[model samples]
Structures are given as structure tokens and as C-alpha cells.
Target chain A: MLTKRIIPCLDIKDGRTVKGVNFVNIRDAGDPVELGSAYAQQGADELVFLDISATNEERKTFASLVRDIAKHINIPFTVGGGISAVADVAPLLEAGADKVSVNSAAVRNPGLIDELSKAFGAQCIVLAIDARRVDDQWTVHTHGGKKATEKKLFEWAKEGQDRGAGEILFTSMDHDGTKSGFAIDPLARLNAILSIPVIASGGAGNKEHFIGAFKEGKADAALAASIFHFGEVKIPELKSFLKQQAIHIR
Target chain B: MKLAIIKYNAGNIQSVSFALERLGVDFHITDNAEEIKTADKVIFPGVGEASTTMKYLRDRKLDLVIRDLKQPVLGICLGMQLMCTFSEENATECLGIFDESVKLFKPTAQDQKVPHMGWNQLRLKDSWLDPSLEGEFIYFVHSYYVPVNPNTAASTDYIVPFSAAMKRDNFHAVQFHPEKSAEAGERVLKSFLK
Candidate 1:
């Protein structure tokens, strides 16, 4: 059986690991390579490295960092942010990153998803959707939750699947870092719509939050930043707790 | 050494070559039988309907060359489907290197997803076929699957049971995308290359 994945996301800025309070007040955690290795040792199933800054220099940093981490870790890592073109993917994958996640760039040229999926194969491409609840519907957000896309969350997720996106990492911006636990209702809606494995992000305050995500939200994986980054929840302890809760863990 | 990716009306050849170039492996994307026959390894990859693909391969005599290769060969996506006896896609007859048929994945009790798309786990069957492939999740995206048989080296669950990876002697194929499969995928590729 494919074990339910436990992923810890690292918001990288200028080639270093950083965690913020509600996507603001960013602070450096440590070197990305070291931090990634630690996560792997702690039995993290996968890692997602988001550049978090939209700039040429930051992208280069992320690309280089992905390569650096890939060389050291024998697990999958996805690099997001400022990835604008097919050309952008080459350097990062070369640097040892297994997959590349596209956000604003993909929304702009939905065809870019096909192009990248075709160029790199479907599994190499990841579509990261930042969603926010708007008027009783979860609407897609772009530019790292800065802009609202007209595309509904599920509609676009199905589109991403059709376009050959390997996985859907859906993050709830309203619940991110809130520790209110995942917005189970919106995530459940997405889980019903997306045939792909959904990585639930945001609003994880406790171990039960993860169990709720896998059970209530039907998420393939649960991702947290502040909880793991701040040492509030140790990964091993959490995994044991989930295992006791009968949620499959590695 | 030159490596040839047998292009039987499939997806990107340049992308595979790009990955090879990064790994410093010399390769080419070719449909020419002579070029494929002479390469160190042959990779057969596909991204479209299998019936149309088999028709093209049969027309070009590529099917014979694929069956006859002695060196390491890799098949991805539909290419993996073609390596089996037949595919459910368009009721197509495929290269019967593996004695299994690709069947459609219908909506089942728990699995309502039509096209099983995403990164899923591979319960690698421990066998001499490929020990390195055991227990890793390879990325997958397919609506149909080759029912688990004696030849299956790995399996996954979607709408129903599906072969995540298959190994038949020198002719190895994976339903999941190894090039896209992250670390577990990297390990699978390393095992295949070994």
C-alpha cells in the first residue's frame, strides 16, 4: 500500500529556509540542505520547497538549492515560485529536484501545463493551487494568494488533472498558520472533485489535525510549516500519534 | 555511447534526452530502426492512444526491433502498456512481451477517480526481477491497468488493483513515470539502469 505521505514545506527565500507567521514576518530557519535532511531523517515522506519570492535571483537560488538538496537527500522535493517557462524547469531538475510546481505561470498560460507535462512527462509537473473561501465557494488564488482567479477550485483542479499535472498541492490561504486545523469542509469538496492525490496544506495545529485531514479531508498528505518549523510538534511524535490513530504512516 | 528513444508516436523525446544530458548520458530520440538497434539502450515511450501507437509501430517495423533488443530498455506510460499483450484503449492488440492485458479502470466501490492521476505508492513485489524497485511510490496517470499477473514486479491501488511497475526479463516497463517519480522514482530508475 502507498503510505499516506507526511510532507513538510519549506518556504525558501534567497537560498535559505524561512517560516513566516501567516506568510508575513519571514525568518530564516536554517540552510535548506540541512533542514531537508533533518526532515527526511524524521521520516518525512516528501518535501516541498517554495521560492516564496518572485524574482530572477530568487528563482536561481531556489533552483540551485533544489539541486543541492537533491544531491544530498534521496527523496522527492518540489520547487515552486517564479517558475515562468519550460526553460525554468531545466535548471532545477538538472540540479536534482525531482518535480517542479508552477502556480501563477500556469494560470496565465494554462497551455504551459500541457507544454511542461509533455516536455517533462505528467509526473514531473506539479500544480500548486492556493485557494480561499469566497462567497461560500472556494475560489482559486494566484500570485501566492495575492489575486483571485475566476476559476473555481475544483474546476481548475480537474483541468490541471486533464492537463497531466502529476499532483495537486491545494493550500487554504485563510486557514494557513491559523492552527484552526484544516478547513475540512472545503478540502473534502476538493477531495471529491480531484481524482489526483491532494496534499492538504494549512491549519494543522495538532496530530489530530492530520488525522482529520486524512480521514475527514481524504487528503493523500498533510503539510504544515509553522507547527513543524517552530518545534511545536515533533515529526516522530506526530507520526506515532497518527499510527496509533490508525492512519497509515511509514 | 549513443542511446536511442524509440519514438512510436509518443511524448517528448527531447525531454528524456535533456535528463540524460544532465546525467551526462549520450542519447537520441529516433524512430529509425537501424538507429535504435545500434544504441546502448532503447527507451520506448508513449503519451497517446495505444491503438494508434501500435498501428504506427507495426507500420514502421519498430515492434520487431523492440522485441529483439538485448540491451537495457525502458518503457514509460503508454509505452509500458504496449509492452503487454494488449491494451483496453481502443481494444488494441499490443506487443505481447508480457502475458497480460491492459484493462479499463471502472468506477469501483471506493475509487471513483476515472483516470488515476497523481503520485501513488508502489508495493514493489520482492523478486529477482528487480529487487531495487520494491516499496517505492512512482507517479502514475492512467485510466486503464494491466491486471496483476505473474510478471508484475510492483502494484498500486486506484479504482482497483493496478500494476504500478512490470518487469519481463530485459523488457522492463513502469506504469508510473520514473522520470517524473521523485526519489522513489530515482531509485527505481537506478535499479532499472543496473
Candidate 2:
């Protein structure tokens, strides 16, 4: 039986983990490798590292960081942010990233998905969409939610799957950082339309929100950042909670 | 013991290599016939279109070399699919290490997805690979699969029950990626090398 996955996302800026993580096992909050290994020890199904660094030197640092994390952590990890072309992917994969998430790049040139999917495979390409509810419809946002595109959330998600994306990481900007809950309605909407797995991202505060994402929103996986980074909700405790609620978790 | 991963035009070899590195096992990723034949254990791994990869192997004459490897061999994902009799992936004939065919998943229900991605449990049968992994959740990311057959060492249910692990004589193949599957997967890989 396929179980719902729980993923903790880390943001990297200037070769360091952005959100300060506080955990007894993890002493270096800035070190991604230490944080990733600690999360894996706590039974995080997978980890996503979004490189928010902009400079060329920091990109090099991110590469080595990815290499180091792959050496230390046993679970799969994804690297995202600033991936623009086919040439950009091999270096990261070689650096030990299991999958690479494409957001603004895919929006700029959708053919990159097909090319990456061809060179690698669909399983290695994750299409990430940052969306915000505009009026009654959800609109796609790019540049880390700075720019909004005409692409509707559901339409872009469908296109993502059709263009050979293995999964869709749907993040709601409205719900992000609020910790109110996930954008459940849109997540369920996206889940209903797409055949591929939908990873619900943004706005996970407590364990109950995770339950809402899995049970009510019908997400294949729920991804959060600060909630996990701050040690508000440990992965094992959340999984146990979900299990008690009869939700299959890994 | 020296272990070698069969290198081809495929993805995910780095992840496998990293897994081995974590286990403190030294390995070589090569396409050379002699190097593969000399290794104590050879892992055939791939993640690409079947027909094109087959063509690449045949062009390099690796197909013949791999068919003759007598040492214990393990194939992961696309490697396992290529080890079968034939694959519906591109209507291509495979290495035929196991007398079975690979076909794309046809989801029984409407919402059931193809490509069957994510963590799934295995109903393991007695095998030398690892008895502990029986009913253990492992990672899988593929669309095509081999059906339940005589070679099946373990079975899993997605839309329908399919072979998650297969074994025949010295050849062992798994439809899942043990390299990416964390703790339980590390145990399975360690057992395979043992």
C-alpha cells in the first residue's frame, strides 16, 4: 500500500539554512547537511532544499552542500530554485539531488520540463507552483510569489502532469507563514484533477493541519517549512498522530 | 568485496553510489565488460526510456556481456524492467534474465494514477535479499511494472497487486529504489552485498 509522505522543506540562502532550526540533535542550524540528517533521523520521509541564494559563489556552495547532504543522509532529497535549463540539472543530479523542482523556469519555458523529463525521467522532475487565491479562482505566481501569471492553478497543474512531471508541489502563498492551515480547498481541487501525486505545501502549523491536508484535502504529501524548522511539530509525533487518526503514513 | 554498478545512459546512479558510500562499501560505476565481470557483485541500474537504453547497450555490445555475468546481479527499476523477457515500454525485447514481460500500469479506478509514485509496502516471500524488508515500506517511482510471476519474490498493491521484487537463481531485481528508500532500504542493500 502506498502511504502518504511527510516532507520538511528547508530554504537555503548564502550557503546556509535560512530559517533557524532549533533541535537538540541539530546543533548547526545553518548547516543543511546537519539539519537534513537530523530530519531523516526523526523519520522525515523526504527533504526539499530550496536554494534561495542568488550569487554565483553561493550556487557553488549549494552544490557542495547538496553533495555533502547526499553523503550523510540516506533518504531522498530534492533541490529547487534557480534551475533554468537542461544544462543546470545534470550538475545537481550529479551533486546527489534525487529530484529537481522547477517553478519560474517552467513558467518561462514549459519545454524545459519535456527536455528534463527526456534527459532524465519524469520521476526526477517536480513542477512547483506558488499559487494565490485571486477572486474565486487560484492564479499561479512565480518569482517566489512576487509575480503572478495568467496561468490558472488547476490548468498549470494539469499541464505539468501532461508535460511529464512526476509530481506537483502546490504551495499557497495566502496560507504560507500564516500557519492557519493549508489552502485545503485548492489542494483538494488540484488533487481531484491531476492523476499524478499532489504535495500540499505552505501553511502547516500543528498536527491537525497535517490531518486536514491528508484527509480533507486529499494530498499525497504535506510539506511545511517553519513549523518543522522551529521544532513545533516533529515528524514522528505527527506521523503517530496521523496513524492514530487512521491515516496511512510513512 | 568489490561491487560494481553497471553504468549506462540513465539517471539515479549517483543516489545508488551515495547509498553504497553511506554503507562504507566501495563500488565502481562502469560499462566495461571486463570490469563488470570481475566485480564480486554487479548492480544493473537505470532510469530512462527502455528502447533507447537497449539500443545504447547493444551498440556497445554490453547486452551480450551482461547476459553472461555469473556473479550475483541486482537490477533496480529500469534495470529490473530490462532484465525481463520484454517490455511494453517501447515494444522492445529485453535481456530475458527472468521469463516475464513488463507492461504499463492500467489503473483500475478512475482516480488511481499511473507512474505509481511514492512509498508502498511489500508483501515479501522468502528470499536471500532480506527477510526483514517483508512488509516494509520502500520507495518506488515508475509507470511500467512486471506482473506477479514465478520470479516474484515480493508483491505490492497499487491499483492491483504486482511484483515489487523478483529473483531467479543469481539474478535479483527490484521494481523499487532501495537506494532512495532510507533505513529499511539500507538494510536491504547491505543484505544484497552480503
- Fraction of native Cα contacts reproduced by each candidate: 0.19, 0.74
Model 1, residue B165: what's the lDDT?
Answer: 71
Off by over 4 Å in 1: A20-29, A90-96, A108-111, A114-122, A148-151, A158-166, B1-65, B71-79, B85-95, B109-126, B129-144, B154-156, B164-169, B172-194
The iRMS of model 2 comes to 1.4
Score every model by TM-score.
Answer: 0.74, 0.97
RMSD of 2: 1.2
- For model 2, what is the alpha-carbon lDDT of residue A32? 87
Model 1 chain A weakest lDDT span, ten residues long: A20-29
- Alpha-carbon local distance difference test for all models: 0.75, 0.89
lDDT of 1 by residue, A1-250 (tens): 4557788888888887777423212333467787777777777877888887656666666766776776666456778888878998877765666678998888888999998887766656889889898998889998768899898888898899899887888889999868988878877877787666788998999888898899888887788887887777888999999889887676
The stretch of ten residues in a row with the least summed lDDT in candidate 1 chain B is: B12-21
* lDDT (Cα, tens digit) per residue for candidate 2, span A1-250: 7889899999998779998777775578888888888898888988999999888888888888888888888888899989999898899998888899999999989989999988888888999999998887799999889898999999999998999998999999999999999999998888788888889998888999988998889999999998888889988899999999999887
